[model samples]
Every structure is written in C-alpha cells, then in structure tokens.
Target chain A: MTALAPAASPARTPLGSSIARTLRLGVLRAGYEIRVYFRQADAIFFTFLFPVLLFGIFSVAFSGQGNIGTAPDGSGGISQGAYYLPGMAAAGILLSGVQNLGVDIANERSDGTLKRLAGTPLPVVSYFLGKMGQVLVTGILQLALLIVIARVAFGVELPTDPAKWLTFAWVFLLGIGTSAVLGIAISRLPRRGKSATAVIIPIVLVLQFISGVYLSFTMLPVWLQDVANVFPLAWLAKGMRSVFLPESFASAEAGGAWQLGTVAVVLLLWLVVGIVVSRFTFRWIRKDS
Target chain B: MNNIALPDAVVSVRDLAKRYGAFEALRGVSFDIHRGETFALLGPNGAGKSTTIEILEGYRDRSSGAASVLGTDPQSGGLEWKSRLGIVLQSTGEQGDVTVRDQLAHFASLYPNPRGVDETIAAVGLADKARTRIRALSGGQRRRVDVALGIIGRPELLFLDEPTTGFDPEARQQFWSLVHQLKAEGTTILLTTHYLDEAAQLSDRAAVIAGGELVAIGAIDEIGGAEARVPLVRWTEGGTRHTERTRTPAGTVASLSARLGAEPTDLEIYRPSLEDIYLDLVRENAEAAAAEIDADGPTSPTTRPSATDPITEGASA
Candidate 1:
C-alpha cells in the first residue's frame, strides 16, 4: 500500500481581503441555517406563523366593530383589520428577530454547538452575520404572511404610495436589526437550553403588551404610554401605523402625530444599545471559563 | 522538568495549570509532542485530560503557564493558525437536521486545504450513511461523523479526545487503521483514551496523569520505568501462595524448584502488561496522597488497604 502524503501548506490570503471572505462564509452559513430552521416544526409554528394566526383571530373578532379613527378628509375611518395589521406585522418582526434568535442561540450554546465552532477557524463575526441573515429572511416572510392575510382574507387595504412603502422598508430593517442584536445580547441570560424558552418568552410577551402590539398605545394609561416610549417596539409599531393608517389617525397617537423622525431616532438608539450590550456579553464558550 | 522547548515539537506545554474557583482541575503539567508522533494522554475520569486538550484547542483559556500549538500561543492563535489544527472534542452537541455529507461539506469549506468529503466519509467507514441525517444514525455511526469532521480539514495536527468511546470492537479496529493512516501521512496526533490496548497499539509515546499531575511520560513500552515491568514468579508452597517479583523469572523459578519444590504447585510467571504498570502507578500516587493527608492532620480516618492489594504485598515479598 502506498503511504499517505503530508498535507500541503495552506495558501495565505492577505488580511485586507479577509472581510470579503468573512462575508462570503457568513452568507454560506445563512443558507445552512435556513435549511435547518425550516426543518424544525416548532420554529415554523411559533416564530413564523404565530403572528398570522393572531392576525386572523383579531380580525374576525373585531370585524363588526365600527371604523377605528377618522380620516383628515372627514371620511369614514379604516376597518379593524387595517388598524391591527401594522401592530401584528410589528409583532412578527419582534418574534422572528428577538424571541426566536435568543432561544436558538441559548440552545446552541448549551448543546455544544458553540463549543465546537469556537475550535474552528470560522470568525465569530461571521457566525453572528449568519444569525442576522436568518432573522432577516424569516422576519420578511412573517411580515408578508401577515399582510397577505390582512388584505386577502380580511379585505384590509394596503398602502400603495411609494413614500409609504419607503417608510415601511426602513422600519422593517431597523426593527429586525435592533431586535437581532438584542437577541444575541440576552442569549447569555439562560443557563441551559431547557430554560431558554422560559426566560425569553416572558420578556418578549411583556414587551409586546407594553409596546402597543397587543393594545393600542393611545388607549393605554398616560403613564403606560410614557413607559412604552422607552423601548424600540413602540416606535416600530408606530412607524408601521404611519404607513397603513391615514394622516388623521396620527392625531390619535400619544404625541398627537406619527413623529416618523422620532421613530427613526428611537430605533437607531436601541440598535446602538444592542450592539454595545452584545459586545460585552456574547461568548464563544460558557461563563465557566 | 526541563523548560527548554523542543525545536521540532508541534505541541509544547510547560507548567500548565487550570483552576475553577477552589477546585484545581489541572495542576502544573508539562510535556512535548514532536512532529509525526502519536502521543497518548492516559488518565481516569476527571483527571484533566479533556481540560488540557480544550486549552490546546483554544476552546478554553488556561489559568497559568505556557502552551504553544503549531508554534503559536493558543490563547492568541488567529484563524490562520486555527485552520491548521483539527479538534474532536470529548462530546459535542451537533444538530441532527443535516445529512452527514452536507455537514461535512460545510465544514470542509471553512478550511483552506481540505480532504475530499467522500474520501473522509469512506475513511470513517460511513459511506453507506452519507445521505442519512445524522440524528437517525446509531451512536457508533454518529461518532464516525465526528471523526469525519475532524479530518476533513487536512489538519497537520489532529486532537482526538476519546474518539473511540462508543465504537464496537470491529468499528474500533477500523478506527485504529484510519488513525494509523493519518500517522503515516506525517500528521502529529495527540489522543486521549481509556483503552490501554488502543494506546499501546497506536501511540509511540505516552503520558499518564493522576490528581491533575503528570505521573509518567516516556515511550509507550518504557512508561513507569523498567523497575515497574519486572516479571513475577508465583507458586503454591505448602498451604500458602507466594509471589516474588524479580528481574530474572527463570533463575528465580530454578532456585525455588531446587529448594524442596518439585516444579511447585500452580507455578506461573507473569509479565507486567501496560495495564498492570498503569494501575500500579495510579495506586502508588493515590497512596502517597493519602499519606500526605494523614501527615497533615489526624482529623480524617486512615484509608484501609483492600484485601486484593497484591501489587504492594508482592513487591514487599
């Protein structure tokens, strides 16, 4: 038998070009991540489809209720389906980006997946990029499902104006990006995989309730609106409402206007917060080291 | 105790120590594994074998002391350095969603120079299960996947931590042949295993650790020193059994037969196997620890010798 030959030395790529390599690996990792994610029945039901189900339920239950808020032209208000559409879409982004990613990371950490990856040459930044890409894809699909159910199933009118669509795009991007960063930051809170759901669900649920996803922001007590103003989800939902609701409905907001500039500023601030927190908290291995 | 780092050594660990709060998982330990040599780290459970391997793999930070793998300190080893080493951890929690081939392919892409995925799969004896999802594979089959991932990178130095833990006898033989092939390719291997026979078969040199310290480090057959490998002559004399450890078993038996002994009853000569030498070294270390504890104070009860303390009694005899 012929003896095996020694391995040849690896080709050295310059450091300046490593960023491009990292991005390429990150995209490749995202493909595998998406494939694995779709195979899990629970992830599909909870993270991707749960918002659609909630929208369907809320639309049917509130179908007979009169128009929501009056328009500036003295025309009739929009239907209940149109009113709750933005909120549910905002919630979908939060579910896919924050809750799903947080628990998924905790499981990977406890199950030795992170430990194995740490031993490899794959950069940690590339890994995070993979998670962000997964969240972006899943979040977009979730938003589409919500909008389709609202328009086709419940006869809710979607925004057709280019300016409104532009607003929708920025809100969607900033909301999911900030949420994804926060998800990585809080993944370290749960000590084990079994406890990840218990720890993350309550936090996400509480945010949904307080941030105008489950309840109208203006309908809540003045103090509660003040509290909701502190977080990003409130701004995300308000931004979505600006796209779907008529101009007069903006008067119903706590600030008496959509305040699109404030929405952008608040989400940007939270994105920064997530980045700083995750920088300090994220670890390749557990805290035992 | 020599602090001089060998120039050709692929792994040089000197005065390494790791502590987890009050518990010291690894005391000061030192060893060097040269290129193309299969070195075994043998120890019982919780004996710092995994800890040392983890530190070398850069998965865990060392508490103190020096560790240089592939000529770079593991704590600061960059991606270029990491690409050259293969690590098979003691246990990993790989997701079972992907097919074995898919999993191996993704990992192969991460390396600058990688072996063919199908060739690696065949080497691990999992060709038939390539299309199968990893979760559906049997325990032994899943372990082969771990080995496949470890070698797909064409690592110059491969760290196999208990790689054969769940393998059946036949599968273990196949794995041994695969490891031999890797060694033939001039890969420096550091293996940790509970199987003494496996170590004796594969490793050129070995180090035994106990109580977080290196007890013996030398050539596989020469571990525990020549003094520990003496032959024993045992026979039943009158109504009692006697065992004598000697350098020359034939001469000892000859003298005994001439002294009122016609071939003796149940006469047998026993050569100390690697297992025997290993057990003796661990037991001696344990007894020395017990003695030190006793010397410190009389608060704890003394450890009583077992009835089958044959090594101690035979050596005294």
Candidate 2:
C-alpha cells in the first residue's frame, strides 16, 4: 500500500452554499426575535393594545368640547374623535417602534447574541437590518389592527380618499422608520445600565407629555406648545393629525408643519447619533452589566 | 489505518503573543500540531487557552506572533483557507427551542458536502434526543449539538474549544470515541480543555500554555505527560515504609514479586497520570511566577525524550 495518496484537484467552494450561509444567518436572527416576542406576549400585549386602550379613555373624557378651545384655523368645534385619532396613531407608532426596538436591541447585545453574530459571516449591519425587517412587518400588521379598531369600534373616521391613503402610507412608514432610528439612538446612550426598560420609561413619558400628544397643542401654554413644536413628538402628533383629522381641524399655522418636519429631522439626527454611539460602545454580555 | 506517513509539521508557530490592554494573555506562545492526529491545548482559566484556540480558529486576532495553521497565516487567511477549517466555539445560543434534528439539518445546509444530520447525531450519541427541542436539552446535550455543528462541514482542520466542559462521565467517554472516529476520517483536531484526563485520552500530542507562553509541547506521553515522570513505588517493610521512583513500573513490580517471594504486602505502584504531571507543571508554573523565574526552554531533555507515538507529525491537518 502507498504511504501517501496521489495528488487531487483543488477544491471549489460552491456559490449556492455561501449564499445559503448568509441567508441562514439573517433567518436565524429574525426568527429568534419573533419567537422571543411571542414568548413575552404579555409585554407585547401592553405595548400594542395599551396605547389604543388609553386613547379610548381620554378621547371620551374630553369629547365634544374639542381638543382646542380656540381653533387657530377658525373651524368651530371640530370632532374630538377626528383630532385625537392622528395623535393616537403617532403615539402608537412611537410606543411600538421606539420602546420595542430600543429595549430589545439593548438586551440582545448584552446577552451574547450580538457577540455571537459578530463572528458569523453576517455583518453586524445585517443583524440590524433583519431586526428592521421584522419590525416593519410587525408594524404594518399592528397598524392595520389599530385602524380597524378606530373605525369600527371607536367610530373614528379614517381617510377614504385614495391620494390621502397614499400620503398616509408613505408618512406612516417614514414615521415608523424615523422613530425606530431615534429609539435605536436613544438605546445607545444607556449602554452601561442593564435594565433597558427601567431607563427608557422616563424618557418615553417625558417626550409624550411635553410634546402635547395627551393635551392639544392649541391649548398648551404658548411656551410649552413652542417647546413641543421644537421636538419630534410634536411633529409626529401634528403629521398624524393631518392624516386622520379633517384639514380644517389642523392648526392653520407653521407650527403644525413644524411638528411633523422637526420630529422627522430630529429622529434622523438621532439615528445618526445612535449609529455613531453604537460603533463606540462596548456591548456587555447579555445577562449582566 | 492507512499507510500514509506524517510530515514534519502540519502547524508551525514562532513567538505567538496576544494581549488585552495591560494584560499579556499569551506571551511568546509557540507549538506545532502534526497531521492526522489529536493535539490537546491544556491550561487553567485565564491561561490564554481560549485566546490561542480562537486565534487558531480565526475568530480572534493575536497581538504579535508568526503562527501558521494548515500552512496559512491564521490572521490573514480567507474563505479558501476557512473552507478547510472548522470551529466549535465555547458556547452557542439556543436557536429558540428548535428540535435537535432540525437545527442540525439547518446547519448542515451551510456546508457544501456535510455529513448527514442523522449520522452526526448518532456519532455524538444524541440519537435518543433527536426529536427533543434544543431548549429542553441539558448542557451536555447542548455541547453535543455544538460538536455536531462543527464537524458537519467535514473540515480538515477542526478547533474544539472546551468541547466537553459540560459533558457527564459517560458522555465524555463517548465524545472521546467520536473524536477517534473523526481521526479515522482524517480530521486533524486542535482541542483545548481544563480536564487532563481528556488530554491524556484523546491527544497523541499535547501542549500547555500559561500566562501567554508555550510551557511545553510533544507526544502526550513524553511532553511531561504521565510517562515522562517516574512512577511512584511504595511498600511496607516490617510496618515501616519504603519508596522509589523509576520509569519501569511493571519491572519494579517484577522486582517486588521476587524480593517478597510473592506479591509484597501493601505493595502499591502508582503510575503518573497526565493529571499528576499536569498538576506538577501548573504548580511549577505558579512557583516560577512567585520566584520571578524562567526555566530552560525546549532544550530540557525530558521534554523532547522520544516522539514514538504512532500518530505521525506533519505538514497537513
């Protein structure tokens, strides 16, 4: 028998196999996150349905009086159902995208999942993209349910015009994307502190109240209204109002437009800020600080 | 086994070092692993065992060194090189309560020509748990999953870092046998472990790393493995004790047989196991640290005694 085997041809790595590897990596991340969300359905239940539930309580308590005592556009007593619908949508979007993505990503990075993914052929960017992909899929589904609940249960009028629907769709997706980035950016700031929700709660509440989602901008002290106008929450509330409410109900002023554009711009800025900070942050192991 | 003769070297290293900030985890660590054989890398926690294995596996970069694995620089090797390499990292996350068979099948899809999932599961002796959800599996079962993933690729060079850490005694023995089966299939294994018995059982050759340096390397039996050190002998002489150290234990037993005119009462001959020598080496390492001392290098006669193990040294993995 021969001591050494004869030479053989050089091996070729199959192209199909490499593609399979990369796709599998993405699939693993997305699948695991979905499973995690399902496992923690109670938390998810509060995240999605609680915002709509809260809207039901507040809309009727202040119904028929109009959110604004003084209509800047001079439309008299616009329906409370109309005004609050858009604001609630914005609040729902923020509650779902920012709170969910920010907290989950932080916890994933902390737990060895991100570190494990760091070694795979999957670039860290792919993991975030997969997360984005999952969030978008869930957001659309959540929005559909919210719209049905509003139109059918709460007797809130939704836009039936096709052009208005297209506008609604674009702005809705954009708002989701924008706020998602801001949430991610915000998530980066509290890296060392491990209790993700503990840190995010105060920030979410402060923005929600001060941005005038709970109280109408028209009735807010002029100073508070102006301050709200300068933040993304104000923009989200105003832009969303323009979508679901009658045009006459919107503040016929620069501030309403400022509300939408500023939230978009600030969220985009936070997105950039988040990306930069995450690059510098040392992701701790998943279980501990 | 095939009639193939091993080459001079499959792995070659010179002055390998890795540092994390102020700590030098591996200081000028160096050793060679030969072709078609098992080489154990042994050390305690924080002894740079993981760092060295990671570098060899191309998962981490080294601070400084000229180290070649399977003839390619571990630092710069590409997919062409990586295709021939396999790595089982220390821990893998649960793939969300997936069935063991399904997860193995999914991972098997990544390799161009992977071993069948069923066969791999059987090899790791997880046939009983094939249908079990991965989340329900014990730590040892999870490790079996890790090993299944690693070898699914049929890599020529395999890196097993702490592969049997959570394994039960029976599972550990089965794992050792599975390793031998892989060797029969010509997969060169680089193993790191805290268990000396595993090193003695699985490795044809072994290396010990501590404080970022290669303390010793050679055939497992001679590289300060149990065989290099003399066996301890003791007997009762009229209620008093007697003792001696020698390389020949059975011969010592023969002498005792002749002297006592039968087996001597209370005769006990203790052969040095890999654990005994390993403890001595690690202890010697600790003492050397305390005394601020550096011992003689590879020139130490005991280290290079005789490379007479059947597994050949070589330039292939």
Best by TM-score: 1
Top model number, DockQ: 1
- Candidate 1 lDDT, B169-282, residue by residue in tens: 999999999999998888899999999999999999999988778999999999999998889999998789999999989999899989964879999999888889899988
lDDT of each: 0.85, 0.67
Q: What TM-score against the true fold does each predicted structure earn?
A: 0.91, 0.78
lDDT of 1 by residue, A1-289 (tens): 1223445544443333589879988998888888888988899999999989998888788877767765576568888888889999899989988898899998988777887777778888788889989999989888887887788888998888999999999999999999999889889888778899999999999989998987988778888888888989999999999999987788788878999999999999999999888877787776344
What lDDT tens digits, residue by residue, belong to model 2 across residues B85-190? Answer: 6778777553445678877776565455567778888888888889887778888888888888777767777889889988989889888888887787677899
The TM-scores of chain A alone, one per candidate, are 0.93, 0.76
Please, what are the lDDT tens digits per residue for candidate 2 over residues A141-176?
Answer: 667777787778777767788866866776677767
After superposition on all CA atoms, how large is the RMSD of candidate 1?
6.0
The CA-based lDDT of model 1 is what? 0.85
lDDT at position B70, candidate 2: 73
